[model samples]
Target: MNGDWLLRGRDGRLTVYLPSGEAVLCRAERGPGGPWEDAPRTVGGTQKLHPGAAVGQGADRYAHLAAWRPTVPGESGLVHTTHFRPLLAPLDWVPIGHPDKKGDRTGPPAVAVDGPGRGYVFVRNAGGGVSLRNQKVKGGWGGWLDLGGQEIEERLAPVAAESGRVELYACAPGAILHWHQEGDGKKPVRAAEVEAAVRPGTLRALATSAEHTTVFFTDDSGDVCAWRPGEKPVPLLAAAGPGPVSAVRCVIEGHDCTVLAQRSASGRVAFAAYPTEQESAGAWWTESGPQLPSDALVAVALDEHEELVAASLSPSTGTLLLTRRKDEPGLALEAWREI
Candidate 1:
């Protein structure tokens, strides 16, 4: 689907979810040192998922998945599934319904989990506005709350800051709309919009500090740009390719770094690392391994050993490919291994 296919749980396990035909199948590692399961396990009741799916892990360490199902009889809508444990068993796909009933129109969802382990799902409503539904403290879901915006694009990025406040970013026609919570467990209030021409489906958010997050997206020129809440947008890498860029924060050489991965224009996964929020320092983009299919999605995360791990789906072969950062040098990755 997109780059949100990989998830790292609080227990140090990594799970890779892929949309195979009509179902969303997953394979997770056994423990910290994982040889992932030999075969894929189908998430229960996900037989009608629309290929685009988003996943996030809550404070309870459970993986929450949101997907759009467009062919569900009379009214097409969105569905959600949560893993009961870290190892990928006991999943039930529950329908979350759609906001617009006339055309049953809804975009792919973006999920975020607050500090209290409640999950929130966001999507572009039929009227080109943003709508959100979240879980209550007692584990019940609230109704869809329209978080007002106009001409919003299909891609959405949501990040839960280290302080447990969740912030959302959406790309509108000529601006980037923002929504944030004043404090943890509070409703997200819309903030002033940032004017920028961002490429649709290329927005990603990473928490760089306790209360602030840096959002990265491909600009109109195909260059990657970084923007924080109240700061000017800083251009980073140039011509870094398309689709959603994935990022994870880790410590490298005793320095905190943000590592990024995206599918390059040449059909390969490219990576870059720079000091967190220090965009002016410049970043070196490196293309790793052989070329995957152009539609392949890339995701990066930290493993139990604190090593950087990257995963992607091979849509043509219906297999998952994985690689880890090499210890010897700068931004090097071990060979890609199919799982």
Candidate 2:
């Protein structure tokens, strides 16, 4: 799946979810350091789901999954499922219908949960603008609200900052569109747009501060660039890789750092680590593990031990492969193991 597949729960557990056949299958660790469960658990009532799934976790420790499914023949609608406990059980899939009633047309969805545990889902609408739906205070959901934009790409990046404010980023024809909350409990309004030619399906955002986030994406020339709300785009690495890049912030050697992973042109998972938000300081990409079979989606997250964990689905075999960051040096990872 293009969206995040690796999730770290508030209880210090890691769970991986992926699309299997027409259902979403997940596997999670028994406890913190993980002797992960052997077989995959089928999320109840997701047999008709589409291929990709995007997952997000909230402050309440609930994991939210978003996917699209056929509501009627030739028409599709958004479906969501929430997990009360990690790897235990997920509630039934709830339908959040499309923004347009004439025809159920929407792109893949991305979800983010605010600090107070309310969840928000975003997708590109039929007219190529962004639309959002969020969880109400008492329960249930609010109606779909169109956050206007045009020619937006399918891949969306949504991140909730430490201030409990949610921010969204989308790639358009020749620029990146941004939206954010002005105050607590406020809906995100369209903000400044960055002029950059971003490659489709490559936008990724990481919250680098309490109120702001830094977005990373490959520019039209295949170079990786980092940009924040007010700052200019900072070019980080050139010819980094293909497909979307995965990143997570953590403490390394007592210094706040951001670690990134992407699929290299040679089919290997490459890694880079740098001081958080200091892209101009310079960072190098290093190829890690053996080359993957093809353009497998690579993802990274910090485990309970605060070590970096990278995961990807084996496109050739449909197996999940995982590797952890080595304790030694800059962004090194242990050997890859399948589960």
Q: Write the per-residue lDDT of candidate 1 for residues 1-339, one digit (tens) a residue.
A: 543567777778888887887787888888875878888888866466667788886656677888777654655777787885658474677877777753455677889888887888888898889999888767788888888888899888998888778899999998887899897667799986788999887889888987579899888987889999888888998856767788999888778899988888898888899999888889977898778887687888888788899987777777578998788656778999887
Estimate the overall C-alpha local distance difference test score of candidate 2.
0.83
The estimated TM-scores of all candidates read 0.94, 0.96
Please provide, for model 2 over 1-339, each residue's C-alpha lDDT reduced to its tens digit, 9 standing for 90 to 100. 645678877788888887787888878888987789888788756458877677887767678888888777888888788876666788888888887753665788899888888878898899889999888877889888889999889889998887878899998888988999897657799998889988888899888977579899999898999989888898899755778789999887788999889888888888888899888778888988777778477899888888889997775577678898788866667889887
Tell me how far the alpha carbon of residue 267 in candidate 2 is from the true structure, in angstroms, after superposition. Answer: 1.2
Lowest summed lDDT over 10 consecutive residues: which window, candidate 1?
Answer: 97-106
